[model samples]
Target: MLVKSIEKRVQELNGNLELSLDDIFYTVCQEYNLNAVVIEEALGCKCPFALIGFITTLKSADPGNYIQYKY
Candidate 1:
């Protein structure tokens, strides 16, 4: 269900500005009225890496927010 929640949130926040994985996760939590600790526990990951991996999948699926990099 967490992945579903993430997908939905990413869709909702696709416009305006591109957000980092951490921002997306927090936004999803806020939007769904979920506790961060609860989510982390459910995912068995207390770090941002897990969420970043999920966000990468989301970008591949629905890449509305353009990704860019600078060297």
Candidate 2:
């Protein structure tokens, strides 16, 4: 459910950032073999709005690098 919500959000984006928030999420999960649900819930965000703020903050932290729709 968390992954699906994020997918809808990313579909509406321009994808200018090679590494979007969704990418970071999945990568962190895969790289560390963590649980997606547990990690996403920890974020405590509502999709498509506050979530963007979270993403923005992440982008600012590292400049640019996020995406997952390539699959």
Candidate 3:
């Protein structure tokens, strides 16, 4: 799953990725090649804020250290 893959990548990166919200949104959208609406529905969130919250909840990293999709 994407979430699991992201977790694994983050772990491999060793620590936080430190990216802007726009970078995150764009990366996810491009990676999945999904529209914003579809992304929101898939994540069970109505908006970007909620989506971020949902993603954060699924990962083991702290808020400050999450969203780090690196090797």
Candidate 4:
């Protein structure tokens, strides 16, 4: 859900601005009509990207190496 949502959103953008995870989460949830309880159930820190949702791309380290990836 998050992957497709983020992809669609990125494609729609004019490329002037980037979206933070929170921004994506807020709007995507509204777009999908998801509530807080439902989001918590689906994510709830179950995965690394679970904070906002899931990320579709990883240019550096694997999922286990979040900080390295950030750097």
In candidate 1, what residue range of length 10 has the lowest lDDT sum?
62-71
Q: What is the C-alpha RMSD of each candidate to the true structure, in Å?
A: 13.4, 11.3, 10.5, 11.7
- Put down candidate 2 lDDT per residue, 17-67, tens digits, no spaces: 676656655544454343445436746632334443554465446422333
Full-model lDDT for every candidate? 0.55, 0.47, 0.49, 0.45
Clashing pairs in 4: none
Instruction: Score every model by TM-score.
Output: 0.42, 0.35, 0.34, 0.37
Pairs that collide, model 2: 19-65, 19-66, 20-66, 20-67
Which wins on TM-score, candidate 1 or candidate 4?
A: 1
RMSD of 2: 11.3
Sorted on lDDT, best first, the list reads: 1, 3, 2, 4
* Candidate 4 global TM-score: 0.37
- lDDT string for model 3 (1-71, tens) is 65565445434333446755445554554554435555555665433344445565645645332333444
Query: Of the pair 3 and 4, which is ahead by TM-score?
Result: 4
Better of 2 and 3 by lDDT: 3
Clashing pairs in 1: none
What value does the lDDT take at residue 7 in candidate 3?
Answer: 42
Q: What lDDT would candidate 1 get against the real structure?
A: 0.55
> Which regions of candidate 3 fall more than 4 Å away from where they truly are?
6-18, 37-71
